[model samples]
Structure formats: structure tokens, C-alpha cells
Target: MAPPAWTTRPNAKDDLRERARELRRQHRSVPEVAAELGIAKSTAYRWVRDIPLDVDARKALFAREHSSTTGHGQMMAEARWSEYRAERDARQAERVTGAAGSVGGLTQEELVRIGAMMYWCEGAKAKPWNSTRRITFVNSDAGLILVFLAFLRAVGVEQSTIDFRVQIHETADADAAVRWWAAKVGADRTIFRRTSLKRHNPKTVRYNTGADYHGCLIVSVRRSRAIYDMVEGLVIGVVRAAGRPSAPCDPWPQ
Candidate 1:
């Protein structure tokens, strides 16, 4: 005689019931067990409701609930994230390309304004207590350093007037860094000053110790007092033009 209909059904299948119980011990939800085993959710619950989840299963369940990721759900989560990142990257690239196209080229006046703004943010400033006027621009970004050099050239600073120095950790390849800066600046190595070596602290973890790490280039303009006041004036002008009615250039009018 053939097996009864109830015995043939998935809910009543011994193998699926055993599998459902195993998944339940792993903290699989009733819906998940039902969908996976091709059984009704009520049946799945009835089969494994008494199986208590262990600590690992509880943690896995928590991870799955919080981020849609964990033991069994990790592959699905990764696929979803990969798809999301690709879409986001495409959108960002399109917008950035359009915006970059809108900027035709930098004019002399625009370069001056931009250079002054850049200096105001990165260059050293004079204080009343120190009163030493110097033009020292330091940066680790090669592009920014090149732009600053171009700005100096635009402001009538000769290549001979600029001095370059590499400040780096003692563990870094100082000679290689010097060569890199020299090539980037297109200046003779003779013009470069002594490299400053920073003592490496063993206890601290460093992320900048790779082959691409060239440390920082310090550009000190010799006899720069002439253009110091001009940069200051430009920064002051920008600060004062924030709203209607310009204020006097006096930084401390109190």
C-alpha cells in the first residue's frame, strides 16, 4: 500500500523535520526554515520550537538581524553590498565628471585668489608674540605642492628663491624621498636643504610606511617678506567680504 498523504507531505517528512531542527539550533527563523525546507511556517515552528539556540547561534542571529549578514546570510549580504557600491560609484563618477567639465580653466586672477585661500589654510602665520614674517608651505600631497609652486612662480618668486626640505620618519627612505621631491619640483638637488628625520616611536602603529609614502616637502621662500603682506591682504579681503559693508583690514580693531 502507498504511504498516507500526511506522511508524504513535506511537513511530515522525517528528513526535512530533522533538517529544520538542526537549523533551529543555529537560530534560523521559522520563515527561513519553512522557505528552505518547502514546508509551512507553522509546521517549521512546531518541529523546532523547543530547540534552544546556543551562544554562537544567538550571536549569529543578532548579526543577521542587525546587518542582514552572518553565517548563512553572509554571501547574500555581500552580493547586496557589492551591487549597492557599484551603483553609488557610477552615480558619483557621473556627477563629478559633469562638474569637472564645467570648470574650464583657472585664470591668473583666479589662481591668485585660490593660492591665497590655500595659503591661508595651510601656510604658517605670524603672531604678535613671534612677529617673524616667513613664507613656509608644507604638504605631503604632491599635487598640492606642485600647485603651490606654480602659485609662487605666478607671484614672481624665482626657482632660485625657493628651498626644499624633506621631513620624514627615521624609518623611511630619506634619500629616495629627496630624489622624488627633487624630480617633482624640477629643482637641482643642491638647492635642497638637509632632511629632517623624526624619531620613530615603536609603540605607535603607523599606516604611512608604504612605498608610496614620500613624507612631507617643506617649501621655504627666501626673502619672502615682500609678498607676505600681499598674501595677508588677500586673505583679509576675503574674510572681510563675507557680507555687505567691508570692515577695515585691521585684524584686531578692538
Candidate 2:
């Protein structure tokens, strides 16, 4: 025989009330508990409305919710940052392209000024204590050497009057470096002096090595006192002009 309706109905209601209480303990809203239990909202409220929340339980629930939200926010922030970087890089590239277009060719006067500046910084200076006058340019950069050679040519210095030398670590490929520099500066290999070798310490690490490491080149002009004097004057003039209130002439002579 079937059980009485009163007995079964009360049991089902009791189970639903217990589930609602458990949901409240988990810090779920009354509406959410009601929806999950498939019970009437009024019944759900009646079951859990009087329950007081514990501080620790509330904090746990907030943490769970915040974790989900934080992941989404982080992704959105990263996407926006990527877009900003791409736009900035594009603008920089456009500026570089415009600058390249503006520099068509350098005038003789511009080369003279630039050459003097390079010499003043990289070439040996005649100090009051040591007064040896010579147009000696030393650099590791091949491009700078080529510019110096061009400057010398512009000022009517013959190719025969220039001498080349290499200073490098004994551990490096001296012959290979001389060959590379000769090709780079468009000079005869025979003009190069015996490569000066410095003792290399095993404990010291060197960044410059391998195929790309062409050691420093020394380009000395024979009987260059007059040229050296002229370069000194040009450097002094450039410095004085820089100090003046008036804007210096366009560094790039047309």
C-alpha cells in the first residue's frame, strides 16, 4: 500500500529546506539558491532569510568571484597594451623613413665640418705636455674610416700619403682583419703595417670576436701638420659657434 500523502510531502519539503540552508552557508544569494533548488522564491527566502553570514565565509565567496573576474581583466589589459605598442612603433618607423628621405647628399663644407668633429673626438690631440702634430685617426668602425679617407681626398691628400695599421689581441685573426679593413677603406693591403698584438688574458672575456671582429684601425697621414692645423681651427670654430645665442648654420650644407 502507498504511504500517506502527508508523510511523503513533509519529507520532500524538509529535504528542500535543508538544501536551501546549505546554499545559504555557501554565501549564495536567496534568489540564486531558489533558482538552483527549483523552489518558489518565497519558500527559499523563508528557508534561508533568517541565517546570519560568517565573516570568513563571506570573504571566501568574494575571493572565488574575484579570481574569475581578475583573469578576464588581465587579458583585456594585455590586448590594449599590445595595440598601443603597435601604433607607437608604426609612428616611429614613419618618422625614420621621413628622415632618410631628407638626407639626399652631403655638401663638401658639411663633410669638412663632420670630418673635423670626428677627428677632434677620435683622432689624437696635441696637448701642451706632448706636442706631436699629425693627422692620425684611429677607430674600430669601418664607416668612420671611410669618411675620414673621403675627407682627406676632398682636401687633396694623395692615396700614397696615407698609411694603415691594425691593433688587436694576439688571440684574434689579424690577417683576416687587415683584409676586411683594406676592402672597407678601399686601400691597398700592402699599405698596412704589421698588426700590433696585445697579450690576451684568459680570465678576461671579450665581446668582440669571430668573423665580425675587425680590430681597431689606425690611419695616419704622412707630413700632415698643415692639415692637422686646419682641422684644429675648424673644431675651435664649431665649438665657438655652438656657444653663440644665434642658431648655428644648418649643419647640413645644401
Scored by lDDT, model 1 comes in at 0.86
Native-referenced Cα lDDT, model 2 = 0.87
Question: Which candidate number has the best lDDT?
Answer: 2
Each candidate: what lDDT?
0.86, 0.87
* Worst lDDT 10-window in candidate 1: 243-252
What digit string (tens of lDDT, one per residue) describes model 1 on residues 49-136?
Answer: 8987778887866677556434456666577799999999999999999998999999988788788888879988899998878899
Candidate 1 residue spans exceeding 4 A from truth? 1-60, 63-71, 245-254
- TM-score, predicted candidate 1 vs. hidden true structure: 0.71
Q: Per-residue lDDT of 1-254 in model 2, one digit per residue for the tens?
A: 99888776557778889999999988886666887999888989999988967888677655654456667435645787899999999999999999989999989999998998999999998999989999999999988888988899888898888989998889989999899988998778988988888899999989998888888999999999999999999999999888776855545555
Model 2: CA > 4 A from native: 1-97, 248-254
